[model samples]
Structure formats: C-alpha cells, structure tokens
Target: MIRRIAATLSALALTLCLGVALWLNDWIDETEIPPLVLETGVEVLDRDGALLRAYTVENGRWRLPVSYDAVDPSFIEMLVAYEDRRFWSHPGIDLRAFARAVWQRLTSGRIVSGGSTLTMQVARLLEDSGTGAWGGKIRQIRLALALERQMTKEEILTLYFHLAPYGGNIEGIRAASLTWFGVEPRRLTAAQSALLVAIPQAPNSRRPDRFAEAAEIARNRVLSRAVTFTDLTEQDVDWARNEPIPTERRDFPALAAHLSDRALADRPTQATHFLTIDVVLQARMEHLARRATTGLGPQISAAIMVMDHQTGEILASVGSPDYTDHPRTGFVDMTQAVRSPGSTLKPLIYGLAFDAGLIHPQTLVADRPISIAGYAPQNFDEVFRGEVTAAEALQASLNIPAVNLLSALGPHRMLSAMGRADMEVSLPMDEAPGLAIALGGLGTRMDDLMRLYGGLARGGIAPPMHWRAGEAPGDGQRILSPVAAWYVADILGDVTPPPNAPRIGLAFKTGTSYGHRDAWAFGFDGRHVVGIWMGRADGASVPGAFGADLSAPLLFEAFSRIGDRPTLRPGPPPGALTLLNADLPDPLRRFDPQGGSNGPPQPSITFPPEGAVLAYQPDLPVIARVAEGTPPFTWLWNGAPIAIGDRDREVILGDIGLGFGELTVIDATGQAGTRQIEIAD
Candidate 1:
C-alpha cells in the first residue's frame, strides 16, 4: 500500500511540474516586445536607399550601425566560438551538452561553460538582451528549446547571423561587418572573417587598441576554424599575413563609441530611428577628416558633419578628426565637444539679421574697432576697415561688423534664430551679449552648428537635425524665410574663393574660437553642407591659430572628393539687385558697377555664373556677392602690396597687410578658394 501510494504521489508531482513548465513556456512564447529599435536610427530607408549605415541586433549584443552586409565572417565566427561551439552540428538545444555544462558548473567555482548550441544562442539573443542574473539565463534555456522546435537549424543560424551583438549599441553581423571590418558579411574572406568573429568576445574590453594580442588571438582562432574545417595549415596563415590586414579593425572601437554616444541621444534602442546620413557619404567624411588631420599635432580633435541642407539629413558625421587608433582615445568625441565657434558664427548672425529683415546684404556697417560697454570688438587682425559693407565684413571675418549687426538685431532674436536652426545651446538673454555674438562666444555642439549652417544652404528651411535611422518624428519647421535663405546663399556664393580651387559651386564659412583654442571651417556646396571643428582636448590655446589657416584646407580635401556639384534652386530673393540704394563708402565709394561695393542691390551689367573664373592685376580691387547671411570679406596681400581699407570693397590682389601673409576669405564654414593675382606695384 505504501509503495503504491508513493508511486502515485510521484506521478502526480511529475504531472504538476510538466504543467507548470508548459505554462511558463506559453508565457515566454507569448511575451511580445515591440522590436528592439533605435530612436535615432528609427528612419527606415527605401529599398537600396542611400543610408550610409545600419544598426542590426545580433546574438544579444548592442553594436554600431553598419551596412546590411557590413561585417566580416570573422566577426560572425567569434559569436559562434564563444557562444556556441557546435553551431554547425547542433539542431538547437543539446541535452547531453547542457548536462555536461551543468556538471562542470557544479564541480567548478565558475558559471562558465554554457553548452548552448548555436540555435540556443540565437534563441537567447532573441529573447534575452539583459545583463541580469539567473532569470535571463533560465529564460534563455527555455527559449532555446522552443526555438529549436520552431525554427530549423539553418533558420536559427541565419537569425543568429543577423542579430548577434558585436559592440556598443551595435547588434547583428551586418553592423559588426560594417563597423569592424568596414566590409559586408557576404564579402568576408577567412582572415577578415576571423577578425569579425573575434570582436564579440569582449567588444569593449578586447578593443583592437587595448587588447591587440587578444583580438588577434581570437581572430586566429576563427582562422583556425575555417582552416581546420577545410584543408589548410599554419603555413597558409603565414602566407595570408603577407596580405593587407584590415585597417577597419584597427579603427572599430573609435567608430563604435562615436556612434554609441550619437545613438543614445535620440531614443533608447526600443524606439524608431531614421538617420539623415548616406553610408557612402558617412564613410567619405571619415576618410577625408582622417586625411585632413593626418599631420596635425597631438591632442587636437575635430568634428565634421555633412548634411543635406534642405532635408536636414546628416549624411555623415566624423566626430573625431582622427582617433589615435587607441581604444582609450575613443572616449573623447571631438564632434560633440563644446568649443568656441568664433567666426563660424558670423554667417549665422548675419543670417539672423537677414532672415528677420533687419539687415540687407548691401547694408553698410562700420568695420573699424568698436567698444561695446568695455567689450571692444576687433577684426581678426588688430586693424580694421573703418566702414564696410556687410559682404566685406563676412569675407574678412571682421568682429566689429558682426557685433554691430547682432546689436541691431536683438540678442534674444539671434539666439532664437540659432535655436530655430536646431542648435541646442542656451544664452540667458542677458549673458548672451549681442556685441560679441559674432565672435562665437556661445558654447555649442559642433554637429549643431553644422545643421545651423545647413539651414542656410537648404534655402531658408531649417530641417530638424537627424541622426541614426528615421526622419524627424514630425515634419520640420522653416526657420528662415525662403527669400532670406536665398539671399544668404547668393552672397555666400559671391564671396566663395577663386576658380583655381579643386572645389567649385560651394559656399563656406571659417571661424576661430577665443585664444585660438579652436579652429573651424564649415559650409555647404550645392549638395552637401560640411562642417569641420578643430580644437585641443585640454582646452589649451593655439596662438595665432585661426580657422582659416587650420581648417580650410581640410574642407578643400573633402569638397574635392565629393564629385557632385550642387546648384542653387531657383527662387526670388528679398530685394532685387538693382543696386538702387546700396551705400558705398570711400575706397569702395568709387564702386565699380561690375566689382565689389557695386555688385549687390544693383541690376548690373553682368552677373558671373555660379562657377566663374577670375584673374587680377596686382592693384585692381575685386568684389562679388555671396549668400546674404554670410559676412563680407577683404583680401590683404602683404608682399603683393594689396591694401584693403576697412571700407575697401572688391577682392584685389595687392600688398600684404601689416602682419599677415596672402589673406583669403572664408564665408560661413568651408574651404577657401584660391585666386592668383599679378601684383601691380
């Protein structure tokens, strides 16, 4: 009787356990989560859309966004080796293997040796993206069994291939392929495959820079797998080493970290994201920024942005001028750092006034040094042109005119305009002085400033700044008037550097921050608005260092590489160029209807085409119009004997000013065009 009773109780207990297990399984299967999405990358592109990057979830890790097939197989292999050794053989759950892992853990002091097969891992990745303890692990085991029953081995592997985490905020082999290998997973070679496969072991800890040995070891292990699976030897590996190692692997941590910070800003991984970036454009920007800062000094960082002016699509962002290729160095993002913008803000200030109808492109303002309640503003050089046109003030990057223009337009309005441009900086209406506003005293993100300039380039509509994946949650608002935008764009074009530059049909502005701590050059050509910001990480000053000297060349390199030329879309500006009431001061007072001072507000004899070439005699003055928001500029050639009076109008090749070499004008933030002149004196 006792034996029979015990047997019945055992059967009952078993039935109850089975019931509970089934119930939990049903619960887990039914548990639905809105897909893991990145808020910034919530924007979905069309088929073959030109998005420059992708963020995929792979095997339970968060990684960078990459191209669909961007990861190397090595990256994939790393997941297989570390997560599931019998990935090729196991159906999903290996009961015997799971038993062994349990025994090993019981005997050992570690929670190591998970016998989860590739199928189980894929299941875990799908169901468990947590950093918690036993709860996630128990769920993982149950899900693995369910997944094995639900999906074929091939299907599970396929899913695993797409969703494994390789690094920070980056998931899936696709993103790993792009972020680490800078290639597609489909195109991965055995060596490249090994590199990709190795990264996930400890994405952050086994950084290429910090743990080169470990990463290489992990790579070699994947290589060994591919080799052993076939008929290759260490000798083959020896032969392969002669081939090029991946340059991308060397830069992974930096790129991944940069994207991580950018991604976290918009939304958590659960929200939708749309990035205003094209993959090719983003890659191109990084390559160019790296090239530009190749020989620049140590501790110098730069932030670069390429935006579609109208769409506010940030096609590419390179936050670091060039990372030291060191893992720790990856911690600092040059693009996000707040630095003085100096003259880069000049164009925007002018744009603020132009947009408000408070100032005209032909507005005349005294360029001479001016004292504003003990805030004496001066030009980049100590001396200044007494009375100058707005255009000259911009081209010369004069401080006083910008301050004067800001003063005319209320400080509150100027800040408001910046806000409208998607700049995320605050100026307590009182602390943010109008007089020194042109000098770029406000602290702001480099990316923000780029978008602000993008507003001008896009013809007055300031599209909301976008990063990661999706379009702005809502359509953006127009910040500047269309006419105001056009006027600014036009003036920017007029003052653009000469025809000799490799880049053409581009509008740009350059700036220097206080104490020369930062140098910046940014602006838009027809298609892309690129902004570059350079500064010392420690906030050290660079004496005599200004944006024009340091940052313009970097802009040229990028523009030269970006093949497409953008043309201004047609639209009427605020005022006609009849030159009816344009105020021309002395030196410029003798305004040439075809030259400087005589160009704007005048329906003149001729308007040069967007990409025209000009030659000059040493003593002749040159003048042209750019976008209205752009400040007027002057050229002071020291040895060529060119002297542009403060009020001097027109670009001339002549004598050098008192303390400088051949001077060039950079409008907004972009490369300076080259103009050659035969000095007459």
Candidate 2:
C-alpha cells in the first residue's frame, strides 16, 4: 500500500511539473517586450554635435537620451557597485544577496535590503513602476530574466542610465549633470559622478536642487562605498565626501532657443535634430545682441544671422535677443520676418552696373539733387557729394546715385536678376518694380539679405543657405561677373570700421528703413557673412535707431569675436581697371545727367518711341528715327552692329521676328539709346 501511494505521488508531481513548464512557455510567448521607447527631450546640436538647446518632454521632464559610452566610467562603476555588484555575470537576480536578505528578514521579523539588481530595476521602470510590492516584484523578476535573454548587459545598463530618474522631473545622467552641476556627463567630476549614482535610489527625497542635506548624505554614502568597485582611491573618496551638494539647479544651455523651438516644430517626431549652428559662436553673438538691446528704448529687440560664405550654411541664427521677454515680442522670429531692407540694396545696384560695363568704380557720377518724372532722391545726410566717383557715391550711400544707376539698369530687370539668383525681393502690393526699391520701399527677410551678401563673398553666386545636416549644397546661380563682384567687395571693404575695431577683411553695409522701423547691417568676408537687425516687432519706429549707429557696431563686434581680421585683401579682378580721375576718358570723368556720355540728351526712336511694339507688315516699312542728339548714327539689331546704308537720319529694316527684340542707336559722340519692341510675324 505504501509503494502504491508513492507511485501515485510521483505521477502527480510529474504532471504538476509539466503544467508549470507549459505555463512559463506560454507567458514568454504572450509577453510583448516593450520597445524601450525612451522619449527624451528634443535636443538641437551644433555641427560638431555640441548641445545648442533642449526642449522639455511633454511630461515636463528634462530627460535627455544617453548611451553607456557617453557617461563617465567611474559613475557607471559606482552605480553598479551600490545597486547590483553582480550585474555583469548575473542573469537577472543575485541569489546569494536575495538569500541573505531573506534570512535576515526571517530572523528580525522586519524588512531588510530589497536585493534588487539593475536589470530588475530596469524592468520595473520599463513597466512604469517602482513599487516594492510582492506581486510587482515577482512580475519584474520574470521580466528581468526575459530582458536578459533579449538584450546584452551593456544595453540593459544603457536602459538603466537613461530611464532612471535623478530627481524632480529630470531623468538620465546627462540631464541631471547639466541641471545640478551645469556640465555634461561626459566631463563629470568625481563628486558629480557620486551624486548622480545616489540620486536614483530616492530621487525625490534626496534631490540636490531641493534637499541639500539629504543630497550630501546620499552623495557621501556613494563615495564611501564607491572605492570597492571603482578605481577611486581613499583620497578621492575623502575629497568627494567634502564636496558640497548643489544648492540650486542651474539652467540648461539655451544658446539658440528660438531656432531650436522651430526645429522641434518642424521635425515633430524626431528626438534629436542637429543644426549647422556653431554653439560657441552662437552664444557669443546672442550675448552681444542681448546686451545691445538693453539700453535701447522699450519693446526693442535684436536679431543676428551668421552664414558660411563658401557653403552658404547658417552658422548661427539668433531670432531675437531674449526669447522669453514678452515685452519685446521675443517669440516672433525676426530672422525670417519680412521688413524693409532700406539702403542695403544700393551695393547690388552698383555691382549690376559694373557687370554690364555701363559704369566703373572710378567712373564719375553726380550726387547732386536730381529729379526724374517728379521723383527726387537725396543723400542720407541731406548733403550731396557732387562729382564723386561711383565708389565714393556708394560709400557715402548717396540716394541720387543709386536711383540714377537703377534707372539705367531698369527696375524690372534688376528685380528679375535677383530673382534668378534665388533671392526673393518683396514688392509693395500691386505695384510694379520702381526706383523707390533702391531705398527701403520694399520688404525682405534678414536671411535673404545674408544670402545675397554671401553670394558676393562667393564671387556673386548666390546659393541657398543650409541649416540641417545631410542637405546637399547645390551649385549657386551667377548674379554678377567676377570683376563686378570683386569691385563691389573692394568698395565695401573700404568703409571705416568703428572706433578701436580693426578692419577685418569683411565688406559690410548698413541700412535703416523708412520710419526707422528696421535697422540692418550685412557684412561678408572670405569665410563668413553676418546680418543683423534691431527694431520693434510691432513696426513702431524707434527715435534713434539708425542702422549705422545701432547695427554697424554690432556687425563689426561680431567679426572681432570670430577673430577674422582682414587677412586676404582681394585684388582687382581681371578686366577691372583702377584708374585715377585724370586718367579716365573725358566722358567718364563726370557723368552727364542728360546722357551716358558728356553729350546732349540720348537719341530716341521717333516712330516706335518708348513702350512701342510694332506689328510686322510686309507692305509697310519698319522705320526707325532719332528724336534728338548728334546725328551720323550707327544702328544695331538685337546686339550686333548693322549697316545703316549711308542713311544718318532714318533706317528701314526689311524683316523682323515674331518675338521680343531690342533696338539700339549709338551716335558719333558715344551716347546711346535702347528701346524694346515686339514684332508679330
């Protein structure tokens, strides 16, 4: 009878064992291992991956993504030593520590150490819990074993490093390091490492930002015990023990806050978005801009944009001086905001004129008061520099000269040229391109202005600016010939720098919009192009916000910070002449307001006068006649010289095409006139 009972018990035990094995297999298959979705805060890094700015997660936590390799070795060692000494070899649980704890609890009739391994803690965090309840503990033990099978020890450690909370809605060593000590975890000191290791045990009660005494005690515990696992000497532990806990949390780096916010909004799903910004340069310029806006009138703000001249990549883009200052409307991004460009467009006008061989830098031009069809322009100082070289007129920013040059290089054509180079020149509502655009009569963003100046730095090729990695740097469009571009750069480089500032190789220009609503300073050198704007966001005029006074100094100061002194003095381009006034031809000495040369008014097409497009007719003559100026003229069809057949007063073309064409008439005195016409075949 005893034998029969034993056989029955053995059969029952075998059946129970089979059932438990089957249940374990089913649980393993049904359990969906979480993806370890570490939703860290959005981070904007510089070109070299330096942190520029970080935005808090939706839970208001400053959790930054970190890897095992990114942390200090001593911190990891201390963490393992304090939390789970057998983390490297153990599959999930330390049986020896668990047995010791169980024995101590049974003997004392009270709870002792919990004996939780790092992997088990990671499993609990993954399931979003930290309760030490028996049921939760059992579930975490199973999950920890499962996690060990799936992920290596290093990966589980990485999970622990990132998901482990330090204190007060801040997670990960990176965030805690930045918050408590104002440094990166990669450069953590011995004391800083010990503090970080102790925080995760009781993050809230021992938060360094709040409970200083509790934090110091926790830090000392870790330091005293760290020598067992880490390579820290007793001297190191003693030194770290004396280190004071941080009393207050330090603010995270907010170098490019506005840009980082925009990047976050633009790339919503991304946890990390790296920009092309140089964080060091960006911080310096932002500080400078912030300081400059301090003494200015109320509601005033400043913005700056720095670009790589060669690649057209944005190195720094400060949208506003203080992003959180509500009085200044600092939330508004002024770098991409449309505002009047003022006299900054003047240099492009002269550059275009030079490219067309219509004017030289040394060519004489009148800055005297002039009017055309009831529109007259004056100099900025209201005192014209009469009979000055083209370069001098530009340096003085004479409005009359710019208008005259724009008139010669038709406004519509000038706008078209800029458009071809990927620049957007915003015009007034429903208005055609006019000479007033030479002044601040139109709107343009600071970014577009920087790109245009960057083009000048790149020999008149305007390429699109890059702000993100992996973007292709496309070939730019030619806006001006090399000679013309060099000429403009040379003239701008001659401007006097501010007091005590060395002349960097930069060629800069300043512009103040109408009503003083916008102040701009755009500069470029062999390497960088920086543009700045200072004004109120509401378009309200500031009384003393002149571009030269307010923005120019900031521009030069930025150049000084970059340590770019005028090293490469760009020489004159081929086919460009640097002739003196006396060496210039008589006609080029002083511009004739009446015509291209020192002659009478330019001859006009009498029959098909201005704005005339004649239709092609086989029975009628395509007649052309000069209205005024010296006779004995030479006619040109399209752009080539054509025979006049001994006819000085008028000429007749036999045939014409079905498209648009230009007619040119040049007289013996070197004065010329052009008229556009369309002929329907």
Candidate 3:
C-alpha cells in the first residue's frame, strides 16, 4: 500500500511540473521586449574618420554607439572573463553560476555574488529594470532569452557596449574612453581596459573622475581575478594595478567649432557627419591662428582657409582666432563674412589685360595719380611708381596702375570674369560696378578669394570647393587663359617675402583695405592655396596694421606648418611670351588709355554690324571696315589679333572661319570697339 501511494504522488508531481513549465513558456512569450535600436549622439569626423566634434543626444547624454569590432581585444577578453565566463556557451542564464550564488547566499546569510551574464545586464539596461527584486530578475531572464533568440552573440555584446553606463551622463565604451582618457576605445592599456570594465558594474559609485578610491578598488579586483580568468600574467596585473587612475574627465574634441556647428545645423537629423577637413592640419592651423592673433588688440580677430587647388578640397578652415572670445566677436565666421578684398583683385585684373593682348608682364604702365569720372584711386602709401613694368606694378601693389588696367578692361568685364570664376562679389548696396572696385571698393568673402587664387594656381580653371567628404566638386570655369594665368603666377612669385621668411617659391599677394580696417594675404603654390584675414570684427580700423606687416607672416608660417615645399610653378603655355618692355611689340610695350589716337573718334566695325549674319562664299572673302580712329589699327577675329599695325581703315578677312565670331578694332590708343556676327556656309 505504501509503495503504490509513493508512485501515485510521483506521477502527480511530474504532471504538475510539466504544467508549470508550459505556463512559464507562455508567460515568457507574452512579455514585451523593446526594439534594440539605440539612439546615439551626432558625431562630426574628419577626413580620416577622426572625431573633430560631438553633440549630446536627447537628455544631454554622451552616448556614442560603438560596435563590437571597435572595442579592444584585450578589453573584450577582460570583460568577458570578469563578467560571464560562460557567456558564449550559456543559453541565457547559467544554472551552475546560479546554483553557486544560491548556495553561497544561503550559507553566508547574505548576498555573496550575483549570477548575471552580460546578456542579462544588457536586458536590464534596455528595460531600465533593477536587480534588487526577484521580479526584476525574472523579467531580465525572460528578456535575455528573448534577446538571445533574436540577436547573435556579437550583436548582444555590441548592445552592451552601446548602452553600458560609465558615469554621469556618459554611456557606452566610446564615450567612456573619450571622457576618461581622451582617446578611442580601439586601443587601451590593460589598466584602462580593467577600469572601463569595472565602471559599468557600479557606474555611479566607481566613476574614476568622482570616486577614485572605489574605481581603483573595483579595477584592481578585476585585475586580480584576471590571472585565472584571462591570459594576463602576474607581472601584467602588477603593472596594471600600479597604473594611476584618471582624476578628472576630459572635454570632448572641439576642433573646427564653427564648421561642426554648421554641419549639425545643416543636417539636424543626421547621426554622423563627415567633412573634408584634415583634423591634424586643422588643429595646427587653429593653434597658429590663436597664436598669431595674440597681442594684436583686444578686439582684433583672424580667419584662415587652406585648400588643395588641384582638387578644390578645403583642408583647413579657421573661422576665428578664438571661438569663445566675446570681446572679439569670435562667433562670427569671417571666412564667410563679406569684407573689402583690398588690392587682392589686382592679379585678376592684370591677367585679363594679358589675355586681351593689352600688356605683357614687362610692359611699362604709368602709376601717376589720375582721376577718371571723379573716381581717383591712390596707392596705400600715396606714392607713385611711375613707368614701372606691369609685373613690378603688381608686385608693389600700386593702386594707380591697377585702376588704369581695370579702366581699360572695363569694370563690367571684370565683374563678369569673377562671376565666371564662381566667385560672389558684393558691391556696396545697389551701387554700380566701378573702378574703385579694383581697390577694395567691393566686398568679398575669404573663401571666394581662395577660389580665385586657387583657380590661378590650377592654371586658370576655378573649381568649386566643397567641405563634405565624397561630394563631387562642380565643373571648373575658365577664369583666365593658361598663358595669362602663368604670367600672373610668375609675377606674383617674385614678390618679396616678409622679414625672416624664406622664399618658398610661393606666389602670394597682400592687401590693406582703406582705413586699415582689414588686412588680407592670399598665396598659392602649384598644389595648394591659403588665404588669411585679420582685423577687428566690427570693421573698425586698426591704425597702421597692414597686410604686409601682420597677415603675410602668418600666411608663411601656415605654409611651414603644412610641411610641404611649394610646388614648382608650371612652365609657360604655348602663347606665353617672356620679354622685356623694349622687346615687346609696339602696342604691347606701353599701356596707352587713349589708344594713341589723341582725341580721334572711337574705333568701330562698320562692315559687320552688331549681331549681323552673313552668307559664306568659298571663293569670296569677307570685307571688314573700321570707322575713323587712327590710320594704323589692329583688327581682331574674336579675341585673337588677326591684323596688327594695318595702315588701311579696311582689312580683308580671307582666312576667317565660317562661324559665330567677334569683330574687334583697336586704335593706336587703348580705345576699342567690338561687333558680334556669324557667317553661315
């Protein structure tokens, strides 16, 4: 009777256990598990994927997402060994570890060790549940099982890496590494790895920056257990124990502050932004800008930009000397600020003249004081460099010569060229373009000037610059002919460097705006171009502060920091001519604004009226006639000179091509007339 009763009770107990198991499975299935998608802060990276800046996430938390692969191998080993030795083999909960914990707790009458695997910790973090109660533990077990069913081991670990708390408002290994040690988590010393492993266990109490003693104790405990649990030697543990813990948190990287802010503002929903900036170079240049601006004045600020002319990539852009200087209005990005460009535009003016066959580099130009239409431009020093070569005039930055050249080239034409080069020029509110623009009458940004100079360096093709990595640059526009660009480069290369600056073969120019309000320096080699600006942010004059004295030295120092020798200037192009004033052709030898006609009628094309179309005849030649100006005249088909020093008022165009063309007549004086016509076959 007793054996039969025991058998019945055993059968009943088995049926009850089976029923409980089925109910538990149903309960686990019904439990809600949140999605594993973690939200992280926005990060700004440089060209090499180095962090330039980072913004806090919602609730102002510094939680940067890190993958399992980004974590150091040693750190992972230490973490797995210390947290869950059976992490890989266990389903979700380790029954052996649980039994050991229960036995120890029962014997000691208190908690000895908690049997929570890395997955259980990740589950707790995801649900923000606590482990102080049996209910929370059961919830974590269910969630852990569910998570394991859905995610791989690597994915679970990556989740832990992204969600693990380290200290106040800082989560994830990446945030911890950067905060405590100022580096990424890809490479960490044993001590740093141990410390990082320990912090997440009791993040608030073991914060290295707050509770150093607790942090050290926890870190050393992990190191002590590492001997048996990991491959660490006693010697390694000793060394790791002896290493000092960080006492304070470090501020995140804040290089390229203005640009980073702009990027974030431009794309608010983006989680990461990659720029074309080189962080190392950007850091060096920012420091240089700050150092250069020191002691200049309380309100003076500086801006700089460096670009690869060939690729039109902006390597570095320093918006201001200091981003926090309230007195200097440092928040303003001067690179984008519209300011007078001073005499920097002179090079372009001279280049246009060269392309027009008006003057060579060695051609003599008069720089005496002259007034035209009541607009008179004076040199910076109010001194004239009379009868100087065009090259000399440009090198010395004489205002009279540049104004004279611009007058001949026409301010409208100069503006058109700038437009073609993709530069945005701001003429003072609703004012017409004038000769004064040649001498800083117009306002332009530093970046636009960089494009202009970079174009000159790139053989006259101005490529649109881009700041974002992987962005395709726009098509380049022809600003000057290759020969004209070469001539300008050759002339600027001969400019004397500032004191103690070695000639690094850089072609550079300096300009001081009227009233000394702005100082500008722009330079280029065969490969790179850099531009600098220094002045009070409020546009107030700094008396006696000139570009030559202030900005040029900084420009040269920037090149030195770049650690690249200036590339050799290219050879002259096909039509380029290197000659002295005496050797140049008569009309090209001296710039005569009057065209040497002495008050005669302005030259005009009579036969080919403006916008006229003529039929093409194979055997018949087109007849071209010029109105009165001078007996000897130069006729041009399109821009190239076709008939030079012709004594007659009419010239035969036997060799002219049948197509749309421009007819131009130039008198002995600098006066010219042009007609656009097309010949059809």
Number of the candidate with higher TM-score, 1 or 3? 3
Q: Model 3 over residues 376-484: C-alpha lDDT tens digits?
A: 7788888876799899999999989888888877899899889988889887777889899999899888999998998899888896688899884777888877778
Angstrom error of the Cα, residue 657, model 2: value is 29
Tens-digit per-residue lDDT, 1-681, candidate 1:
999999999999999999998897786577443243322233233113433323334343334334324444444554465456676666456777788888988889666666667665565666655533577666666666566656566566666665565656666665556556555466766665666666755667555545666767766766666565544467876665444444344223223236544564645554333444555656677777666666666556666777666556666677675445552253477777767777777777776555433345665667665565687776667887776666666777778777766764557767777776667774546664555666777778788787777777766656666664454545554566555666666666666563345546567788888889988888676667788777666678878677777777777666665656564444554332324233421222221211223333411112223334444344554453223313333222211113323222334333232221122332221112222223222
Stretches of model 1 off by over 4 angstroms after superposition? 1-150, 156-183, 187-256, 265-274, 323-330, 352-359, 428-434, 496-500, 567-575, 578-681
Off by over 4 Å in 2: 1-29, 564-566, 596-681
Cand. 3 Cα-lDDT:
0.87
lDDT of each: 0.57, 0.80, 0.87
Give the TM-scores of the predictions, in the order they appear. 0.57, 0.86, 0.92
lDDT of 2 at 563: 55
Whole-model lDDT, candidate 2?
Answer: 0.80
Query: What lDDT tens digits, residue by residue, belong to model 2 across residues 493-594?
Result: 998876766776668899999888998999887788889899999889988788889999999888777754344646775445677877744334554555
- The lDDT leader among the candidates is 3
